[model samples]
Target: MTAPIFPLSAVVGMDDLRLALVLNAVSPAIGGVLVRGEKGTAKSTAVRALAAVLPAVEVVSGCRFSCDPADIDPDCPDGPHDFAGPRESRPARLVELPVGASEDRLVGALDIERALAEGVKAYEPGLLAAAHRGLLYVDEVNLLGDHLVDLLLDAAALGMSYVEREGVSIRHRSRFLLVGTMNPEEGELRPQLLDRFGLTVEVAAPREVDARAEVVRRRLSFDADPTSFAAGFSAAESELASRILTARELLAQVALPDAVLRQIASVCASFEVDGLRADIVIARTAVAHTAWEGRSVVDGDDVRMAARLALPHRRRRNPFDAPGLDEEQLDNALDDHSNDDDPHDDGPGGAPAPQDSPAPADSSSPTDSGSAPERPMPAPGESFAAPTDTFRTRRLEVPGVGSGAAGRRSRAKTDVGRVTGSSRPTGKAGRLHLVSTMIAAAPQQKARGRTSAGLILRRQDLRLARREGRESNLVLFVVDASGSMAARSRMGAVKGAVLSLLLDAYQRRDKVGLVTFRGDSAELALPPTSSVDTAAARLTVLRTGGRTPLAAGLLRAREVLRVERLRDPRRRALMVVVTDGRATRRGGGDLEDAYRTAALLAAEGTAAVVVDCESGPVRLGLAGKLAMALGGPAVRLEELAADTLAASVRTFTGAA
Candidate 1:
């Protein structure tokens, strides 16, 4: 059955997600967006909505490659098809990556039937070929096979795919906008691979009650009448297309100001972000933002908006430290630089003096002013410069009773309560002293006319040993229940993967928990428990829908861990996220807010592993991007199921 089309404007709350789609539509150079959130966060809806409204592209007919006739480069090896007069027409394509697809299916393979029947080698085009001059979307991208990921990455980077197998070498253009969605609960993406994405935004469930209601309302309405629902928003979709075209034209003339460039740098620097990728992304994103606003010059607001998207994914200095710049720090830096000089003030040399002002208040502080008297205002001609204060540092203190102290107290309390006159068992078997038993027997013998005195009790005569059992580790399964996961058969594959993992968890005797996020909520399906049967059953019935609520899921998983009693006796907590990495529902495309949620979970010391389920033509999506943002390990399901799952789990549990 064909899927119903979703309206673009009806998608609730992710302005950044919408903007990212619009910008990319206008200028693919602005790069792709990474939507990070938990399940049901509407990640897939926005992407599909985008596809529904995407402008049609003119391509050469009968050309499976979707080659643009007008923009054909001189290097075209196809050798200039006749286009001097009339040309055939073709519509833009939107290709989806299926979960169970193989390398041969995705990157084209040797024509087996042709080789056997005709004795000739031929290469069959794959999804990449079909997606040329269109959109290639991978839902749950993090779970994609490594070879497949490599293939897509190669094609995306080179704008072409070269397939060589069975004595056939074929090269073709595979340029297309790649969009991938994932849930961080699945796993994470590799850093080397993650750097390919141009922009990343974290999505979340709508915080406002009304927004969430609207989301549900629209979804229900669409489900009730798909055709009418799609038609209802046709006008708005047309308007959106016009706006995108306007933005595309404006993008060419947009100029990023020097001040905005410095502001972008300042934001990145304040975050102690690694590499210069953040700055570059910020600059490019700012230009896109300006274009989205139909402006020719990048403004301060453009830089601010870009910072929210680009800076979040680049702050990798501390993975557990959150995904983006600290707003308080950013605000302080901006204010510091902006108020660095005051023209109205006068200096001793009759020149304007710099303003001497106190630093901005802390985010949690009530206000900058309190009982302290305000500094005296500088005279009209007097220089007023305050010494810059070094940044202050706060230390975290954790209090707990030492093991030795607890043991001593227990021993002391037990000694005081013991019955002094009563005999107790002692020695290897914790049995009565053998010599004492013999002595008592001898006394009984003596009463019957037998006596002995040379026997003495030995240490071996006492018993005091107890067997100890091995400890169990707690494993948290953070599954992505986002709408993208519901697309095609990805959800079925994810369910199969989860079931397989649950079997392993059961064999290992590890406690497991289940968390799912979709729409505007994240729910703990099951808390950490040793009841493997129940947990596995619940997981088997898991369904996917709504947005990717990544942040909420991470936070909830952490909270679940906190309440779980598995942090001692050589046991550690591990988080395994099975997702595609499309966070389209959380924080409404506000990367900073989404990162804040992820950072909180990481800061609590949860060892997170992200499993990318994004199959077919690869797009990193927000899941992998967030994994990089959190500095977590990311692996594909194929990689995990093939080579790493058992080994990685053993290593993590110190069993290897």
Candidate 2:
């Protein structure tokens, strides 16, 4: 028996998420929804439930591609003649594209061997075909491979698929409501892919006691008796489905007035959004909203709602910056262009509305810390300092090929990356490199003395694709915030350096944690997280002063990393220690204690880099010695600067 889906009408809160899904159903051209939220936030539940409420679709009987009887695809791989074909109505289908699914499974595969030997044009259908005129949902979309994402967005945008892999080319209509649910904590979709989404909604579990309780109550009831719970909401579900159908029909009648158009164009301009895509999306969404509300004309209110859904993902300046629309600016634009019909207004589509590192952690590389000289241990004090500025930094990478999380740092082998070559499969052949397999199979065709004239491919000929792509690493920053290095200007620069490193981490998609040593002990300033914004928040509020207990800081970081490895053992790590390398203690052995802790990290082969903050004609060189102890290089802060990087490299090379 088919499992009952949680009724869409029964879902609580998440008003924006529900509306976004409805809007797309009303008009697929409005594009799809990118639902962002934490796990258990009903991101997937809402999507799956929507399939239940969606109006049933009518397709030509016996059509695997789900062709609309009114307009059959002439180029469909499974086609001949059209209008007279039997038609049937069924509930709209929801197709899922799993993260580990291969390319052959997504776009369907062609029987190359059959064609070469038997002269047959046999083709197999894939998920894109199955999802035709229905809905396609990709859960955990952020974790989906970049190459797969490109394919999804392309099919969504073009409304068709042109499968040209393995020498078999086929075309078919594939218009579906593309919905993706992602947890930002995993990582993020590239901005280019993000902008392709027409609407974006951020969701979270209800915080109110009553609201959360209601959610749990409904969930428990459904889990215990899905059919009974669905039956209870049958009336509400029927009403929503009827409303969606009516909205779909009403969409064509809704008018987009000149003034509403002006508001959309104006709002997009004010936000400085990069392209006219946002404007187009808002216009379509506003029209859909007007129809959805049982109205005939698009109005300012409709535009406002549309802008709320369409502009957040488009206006983000950086991934770390949360997605938001400045309502004040939005209102100003609407008011500013409320009454205007200037042909020279640079109207929509007239022009572009928009606007729009690896570094090694090794000690020899120039890295973290300020340029200030060592100062006396004065009275411990605290201050919250903002980052001085941000600039592009050289890429810092861990020294080996890794098989870690998707990131832009150190290179690793991944199924979706560029194929360097091919290898014989050791286990189950997951990513079969077809051409290589065919090449190996060719020699055996004649040697086996096969009765058949075709190429004789066998299991022994299977080859897996060997691809190379970059992987994200765990970057733990250990900073010295003790009194000995706590001059106001010096500490600010040190924090600035740390902040800069944080930005680098953000860009590289590295999970980052911060450890600060001062006073009597060290604290985990921020736990390692995919969210760089959180780390930066903690960094800005950090205080300086107190005796440096460097050992404690390294120890804390080691503990955090240990826990993290147990959580995700695939991720490699890079330790960045920002210090002047001074450890003062009332009980003594401070420096020795610090060294011993560093040795433990070195023993684990943790990639390390110490940014020597000490500067003067005379130096203690403690930071360099610490770097040596950690089995990494130590470089001055200025060396982290991009412009001076080449000069530093030349200096090191000349010395060598």
Top model by lDDT, which number? 2
Error of 2 at 92 (Å): 3.1
Go through the candidates in order and give the C-alpha RMSD of each one to the true structure.
Answer: 27.1, 7.0
Per-residue lDDT over 386-460 for candidate 2, one digit per residue giving the tens place of the 0 to 100 score: 446556666677776889977788778887676789999887545878778878887787788877656677889
Query: Lowest-scoring 10 consecutive residues by lDDT in candidate 1?
Result: 404-413
Go through the candidates in order and give each one's C-alpha lDDT: 0.62, 0.81
TM-score of each: 0.53, 0.83
- Give, for candidate 2, the lowest lDDT window spanning 10 residues: 356-365
Model 2 stretches with alpha carbons more than 4 Å out: 58-63, 67-75, 79-90, 111-122, 162-164, 170-173, 185-188, 206-225, 319-329, 339-380, 427-432, 453-459, 586-600, 615-622, 642-656
Model 1 alpha-carbon drift over 4 Å, by segment: 1-4, 73-80, 83-91, 317-319, 335-656
TM-score of model 2 vs. true structure = 0.83
What's the distance in Å from true for residue 451, model 2? 1.2
